[model samples]
Target chain A: MSLKKTRFKYLGESLIEGNIKITAILAIIAVFLIFFFILRESLPIFFNGEVQQEITFGKFFQGIQWQPVSDHPRFSLWPIIMGSLKVTMIALVFAVPVAIGAALYSSEFAGRRLKEFIKPVVELLAGIPSVVLGFFALIIMASFLKNIFGWTYRLNAVNAGIALGFAIIPAIYSLAEDALNAVPKSFREAALGLGATPWQTAVKVVLPAALPGVSAAVLFGMGRAVGETMVVLMAAGNAPLFSLNPLESTRTMTATIAAELGEVVFGSGHYHALFFIGLTLFTVTFVINLISWALFDGLMSKLYGAKK
Target chain B: MNSKGHLRKIKDRIKIGLTGSAVLLILAILAVILGTVIIGGYKSISWEFLTQPPKEGMTKGGIFPAIFGMVFSLLMMLIAVVPVGVATAVYLHEYARPDFILTKLIRGAVNNLAGVPSIVFGLFGLGFFIQFIGGSLDRSLGQSGLFGQPCILWASLTLALMNLPMIIVATEEALRAVPQAERAGALALGATKWQTIQNVVLPQAIPGILTGVVLVVSRGAGEVAPIMFTGAAYYLPYLPKLPTDQFMTLGYHIFVMTTQSPDIDATMPIAMGATLVLLALTFSLNIIAIIIRSRTRSQLRKGR
Candidate 1:
C-alpha cells in the first residue's frame, strides 16, 4: 500500500512539473509564431506574381516615391528610411549626452538621499505613455519648438525627435547608471588613492571601465528610438520626404505603418509593403539586441568575473 | 603641484555644474510635461465628463466609454497574462535546470519578445489573432463575423503578449527571493514538491507577483499602438459589453482627438483632459507597484 501511494505521489509531481515546463515553452512558441506569421504574410509579396509586379525590388529600393494609394502606386522606401534615420539621429544627439551625464552623477556623485530621489523621478518619466507624450508634442511642444527655432513646419523631425528623446532618456539613464554602479568599488578607491581628483578619476578611470555597458545602454536606447511609433506618428509631420534636414517634415517606418495599416486592404501591395517595413524593423532591432546582449554579458563577466 | 591641484579643482567644479544641469533638465522636462497637461486639461474635466459618453463629434462630452473600455480591457488582459507569466517564471526559477538548453531558449525568447516594437505586436495581433484565430473560430461555429473582427478580446490578448516578458521577469525575481531552505523544509516534511510550492512558496511570492501584475496593468493601460488596429475604436457609442465588441480607449481616444478630430481647437481641451486621466492612472499604478516592490525588498532583507 505504501509503495503504491508513493508511486501515485511521484506521478502527480511529474505531471505538475511537466505542465509548468510546457507553459514556459509556450513563450518560445509565441516568439516563433510572431516571426512566422509576420513572415508568412510578407512572403506573399515576393512569391505572388501580381504583388511582385506591383512591388518589385527596384521600385521598393530605387524608386523615389511612396504614393501607394494613388492610381499608379510607387513603393520606394528610400524617403521613409531617410526619415527614420534622421529622427533617430536627432534623438540620439539630444538624449545620449544628457542621459550619460545624469547617470554619471547619480552613480558617482549624488548623496544617498539625492540618489534615491533622482532615481524614482527619472523612472517616473518612463511610466508616461507614448500617446500622452505624443499628444503633448502635437498640441504644445511642436508649437513651442517651432517658436524657438523658427521652423517652417510645426511638426517636423526636430520636434518629434526631441519628444522621442524624452521617451528614451529613462532607458538610457537607468541602464547606464547600472553599468556605472557595477564597476567595483575598489576601482574608485584605487583611482582616488593614486592622487587623482574626483572628476579626473570619474572621467579617466571610471568612464573607461564602464564604457562597454554604457555603449550597450546607448545601443538599446537607439533601438528603442527607432521602434517608437506613437510619438513619431503624432509629432513627425507624416510627409514621406527624402531629406536629411532635421527641421523638415518627414515620416518614419513606424509612423508609416501606424498611419497606413488601418486603411490598407489586406493582400494588397501596400499591405505587403508595410509588412516588409516591419520585417526590416524586426531585423534591425534583433541585430541591435544581439550586439547589446553580447556587450552586456562581456561587461558582466568583466565586473563579476564570470558566473559558475 | 599647487597650480595643477587648482586646475583639477576648477575642472571638477565644471563637471559638477554640467551634471547638475543635466539632472535639473530632466526634472524641468517632467514638470513641464505634467504642468502643461494639467493646466490645459483640468478645467475641462468634470463629473459629467467622467460619466457621460461623447456628444457633438467628441467636441463636448465625457470619455466614460473610453475609461470603461480601458478598465475592462485591463481586466481581460490581467486574466489572460498573470497565469501564463507566473507559470513561466515558476518553471524558470523552480522547475527547470539552470543550464538546460530549453531554459536558455525560453530566456532568449523572453528577452527578444521584450525588444519587439509595440506596433509589430499590433500587426501580429491583426494577422494572427483577429484574422487567423478569430476567423477560424467564426467559421467553425458557423457564425459569419462574430470573432473575425477587431474586438476587446484580441486587443487584450495582444497587450498581454506585449507585457508577458515584463511579468515573467518581475515574477522570476520574486520567486528567486524565496529561500531554498523553506522549500527544503516543506519537502523534508514528506510533502510533495508541488504541494510545497503551492502552500509555502506561492504565499510568499504573492506580493511580488502582485507587483508584476500592477506593472503590467500600468503598461497595458498606457499602450495605444498595439490596440489601435487590434480593437480600439475612434468612437464607440456604448461600452464594450462583450469581448467581441470594439471599444474606445483613453490612449486611442487621445490619439483620435489629436489627429482626426474635425474641430481641432475645440477638441484640444478634451484631449488634454483624457491625457491627464491616462497619465494619472499609469503613474499611480506605477507608484503602487514601486512601493510594493520596495516593501518586498525590505522584507527579504529582514528575513535574511
Candidate 2:
C-alpha cells in the first residue's frame, strides 16, 4: 500500500513537472519567435550596407525632404517625427486637463451614485476600439473640421490627434483616479479639520501628495498615444511630405509601416527598414513604460512604506 | 458690501457655466457618434441582409461571408489563446516566485508586448507567419484552392497570439485576488496546493476568468491589421470550411468595403450594418461581464 502511494505521488509530480515545462516552452516560443522574425526582416538592411549609397547618412538625417521609395529618396525623418510629436503633444494638451478634472470630480467631488455611473462610461470609452474611433474621425470629425476651419486637407493630423485624445482620456482618468483614491482618508480629514474648503484641500493637499502617481498616469497616456497606430493610419493621409502644418497630409513611421509592410518584398532592404522603424517604435514605447512602471512602483512603496 | 457680493455671484456663475459646458461637450461627443452609428446602420439591417451574400454594389448587399469569417476565426482564436494564456497565467501567479529574476523579466516582456503597437504585430505577422509559417504549412499540407492559400487558421492563430498577454494578465489578477486565507484553510484540511487551486480557488475565480475570456474575444474580433497581412483576402467568395480554408471577416469586410471596393455607395450601408453588428456583439459581451461581476460582488458581500 505504501509503495502504491509513493508511485501515485511520483505520477502527480511528473504531471506538474510536465506542465511547468510546457509553460516555459510557450514563453520561450513567444519571446524567441518575436525576436527572430523582427530581426530576420531587419537583417537585409545591415547586409546591404554598400547598397545604402543613394544618399549620405547626413542628408538622410538632416534633409527636410521625406520621400523614401522615390527615385531620389530623401530619408529625412524630421518632418514625420515632428508631425508625430506635434500630434501627441496636442493630444496631451487636450487630454491632461480634462482627465485631471474628471478624475478630481469622480474621486473627490461626485456623489457615490454619480461616481459609479461616470466611472464605467469613461472606461467604456477606453474600451472602444481605435478602429471605430478612427472611422468616426475620418467620416465625421474630419468633415466638421473642414467645414469649420476650411482646411485644405480634410484628413489631417489635428482630427487624428483629437480622436486619439478621446481614446486616451479614459486611461489618464482611471490611472489618476487610482492615484487619487490611494491618498489616505486621514489626510483629507486632517485638511478638513484645519478649516480648509474642499476645493482647497483637494488642490493643495491631495494633488501634491498624488503627484508621482499622476505623473505615472500621464506617462502611460503618452505611451498609449505614441504606440497608437490605427487612428493615425486611417486618418493621417499617408503622404510623406515634410510639413509642420497640421492641415497638410503627413505620414508617421507607424502609419507607413502598416500601409507598406504587407506588400514589401520579403528579404528586401525596404523590409528591414520597416523592421528598423518597428524597432524605433518599440524602443520609444518600451522606455516610456519602464519609466512609468518605475515611477509607479517608487510612489507606491513611498506611500505604503514597503510590502506587507 | 455691494461690490463683494456682486463679484462673488459673478464668479459662481462663471464657474458653473464653464463646468456645465465641459460636461455637456463630453456627453454630446459620445451621443453624436453612438447616435450616428445606430441611425445609419439601423436602416440597412434586415433578415435578408444578414442571410444573403453581397450584391452588385456593396451598398445593396449583405455581409454574410464577413459574419461567417468572424465567427469561424474567433472560435479558432479562442481555441488558440485560452490554453496558452491560462497556462502562462498559472505559471506566473502560482508557480513563479515574485522576486525571481526570470519572473520579473517575463513580467516586463509581457507588459512590453501589450505596449507594442498593433501595426508592428501586423508587420511581424506578414513577414513571419504568412511568408514563413503559412507558406511552409501550405506547401507541406499540399491542399488545393482556399487550403492552398494561407487563410482562416493563420489569421486566427495570429490574433490569438496577439490577445494572449491580455488574458494572462487578467487571469493572473483574478487568481491573485483569491483570498490567501481560503487557500490556507483548504491546505490545512489536507488538500494539496494543486488540489486546492483546482477545487476551491478556481471555482471562486471562474467569473473573473470568464471576464478575461470575454475581453480577449472582443479584442480579437475587432482586430483588422494583423489579419490583413496574415491571411484575410480582400474578397473571399465563400466562407472558410476546413483548417486550411481562406475566409472573409467583418472587420476586413468593413475596411475593404469602405476603402478598396469601387462601388462605394452600395458598400457603405452594408459596411455600416456589419459594423453595428460587431459593435452590438462586443457591447453585449461587456454587458454580460458587468452583470456577472456585480453578481459576484454581491455574493462576496453576502459571504462576508
Candidate 3:
C-alpha cells in the first residue's frame, strides 16, 4: 500500500512539474511567435510580385509620397520615417535634460522623506494611459502651445513631442536614478574627503561612473517615443510631411500603422504595407533595446567591479 | 583664492536650483494633467451616464456597456494570465538551473518582449491570434467565422500576452522573497521539490502574487492599442453575450470618441467622462498594489 501511494505521488509530482514547464515555455514561444507572425505577414511586401508591383524597394525609399489608398497607390517610407525621426528628436530634446536633472536631484540632494514622496509621484505619471495623455495633448496642450509659441499648426510635432516627453520622463528618471543610486557610497565619500564639494563629487565622480546607465535610460526613452502610437496619432495631426519644423504637423511609423491598419482590406498591398511599417517599428525598437541592454550590462560590471 | 571660492559656490547654487526646478516641473505637469481631466469630466458623470449605453451617435447617455465589457475582458485576462505567469515564475525561480542556457534565453526573451511596442502587439494579435489560431479553430471545427474574427477571447489573450512580462517579473520577486529555510524544512519532511513549492513557498507568496495581479489589472485597464485591433468595437449596443462577440472598452471608447466622432465638439464631454473613469480605475488599482507591495516588504524586513 505504501509503495503504491508513493508511486502515485511521484507520478502526480512529475505531471505537475511537466505542466509548469510547458506553461513557462509559453513566454518564450510568445516572443518567437511575435517575430514569426510579423515577419511572415510582412514578407509579401518584399517578395510577392503583386505587392512588389505596388511598392518596390526603390519607390519605397526614394518616393516622397505616402498615399497608400490613392488611385495609384504610393508606399513611400521616407516621409513617414522622417516624421518619426522629427518627433522622436523633439521628444528627446525635451525629456533627457529634465529627466537627468530630476534624477540627479533625487539621488544626490533630496532627503529620504522627500525621495519617497517624489519617486511615487513621478511613477504615477507613468501609470497614466497613453490615450489619456494623447487626449490632453489634443484638446488642451495643442491650443496652449499655439497660444504660447504662436505656431502655425495647432496640432504639431512639438505638441505631440512634449506630451510624449511626459510619457518618457518617468522611464528615464527611474532608470537614471537607479543607476545613480547604485554608485557605491565609498566613491562619494572619497570624493568629498578629497576636498570636493557635494556638487563637485556628484558631477565629477558619481555622474561619470553612472554614464553608461544614464545613456541607456536616454536610449530607452527614445525607443518609447518612437513606438508611442496614441499621442502622435491624436496630436501629431497625422500629416505625412517631410519637414524639420517642430511646429508643423507630422506623422510617425506607429501613427501610420494605427491609423491605416484598421481600414485596410486583408491581403491587399496596403495591408502588407502597414505590416511592413510594423516590421520597421519592430526592428528599430529591437535595435534600440539591444544597445540599451549592452550599455546596461556595462554599467552593471562597472558598479560591481566585474560580473560572474 | 577667496573670489574663486565665492564663484564656485555661486555656480553650485545655480546647479542645485536647476535640478530642483526640474523635479518641481514634473510634479506640476502631473498635477495639471490630472486637474484638467477632473475639472472637465466631473460634471458629466451622472447616475444615468454610468448606467446606460451611448446614444445619438455616441454624443449622449452612459458608458455602461463599455464599463461592463472592460470588467469582463479584464476578468478573463486575469484568469488566463495569472496561471501562466505564476508557472513561468516558479519554473525560473525554483526549477531551472541558474546557469542553464535555456533559462538565460527565456530571460532575454522576456526582457525583449517587454520592449515590443504595444501597437505591434495589436498587429500580432490580429495576425496570429484572430486570423491564425482562431481561423484554424473555425476551419477544424467546421464553423463559419465563429472564432476567426475579433472578440473578447482574442483580446483577452492578447492582453495576457502583453502583460506576461510584468506578471512574471513581479511573481519572481515574490518567490525569491520566500526563505530558503522554509523550503529546506519542507524537503526534510519528505516533500518533493514540487511539493515544497506548492505547500511551503506559494502560501507565503500569495500576497506578492496579489500584488502582481493588481499591477497587471492597472496596466491592462489603461492599454488601448493592444485591444484596438483585436476586439474593441466603436459602439456595442448590448454587452458581449459570448466570448466571440465584440465588446466596447473604456480606453477604446475614449480613443474612438476623441478621434472618430462625427461631432468633435459634442463628443468632448463624453470623451472626458470616459477618460475620468479610466483614470480613476487605473489609479485605484495602482494604489492598492502599492499598498500591498509595501506591506509585503515590511513583512519581509521584519522576518529578516
TM-score computed on alpha carbons, candidate 3: 0.97
Task: For candidate 3, write residues A74-187 as lDDT tens digits.
Answer: 888988998899999989999999999999999998898899878878868888989999999999999988998788899988899999999999999988998999899998
DockQ of candidate 1 is 0.81
Could you tell me which residue pairs clash in candidate 3?
none
Q: Which candidate do you rate higher for DockQ, 1 or 3? A: 1
Runs of candidate 3 exceeding 4 Å displacement: A306-308
For each candidate, what TM-score against the reference? 0.98, 0.91, 0.97
What is the interface root-mean-square deviation of candidate 2?
Answer: 2.9
Candidate 1 Cα misplacement greater than 4 A, ranges: A306-308
The full ranking of all candidates by lDDT, starting with the best, is: 1, 3, 2
C-alpha lDDT score of every prediction, in listed order: 0.91, 0.75, 0.90
Model 2, range A18-57, lDDT digits (tens) per residue? 6964774575567567767877766555556644554333
Please state the interface RMSD for every predicted structure, separated by commas: 1.0, 2.9, 1.1
Tell me the tens digit of each residue's lDDT in model 3 across B166-238: 9999999999999999999999989999889989999999988998898899889888889999999999778
**Residue-wise lDDT of candidate 1 within A1-308, one digit each (tens)?**
59999999899999999999998999999999999888888887778898887786667887688899998998989999999999998899999999999999988889988998898888789989999989999899999888987889999999999999999999999989998998888889999999888888888988899899999999999999999999999999999998788888889999999999999998888898898888888889889988988898799888887223
DockQ, each predicted model: 0.81, 0.42, 0.76
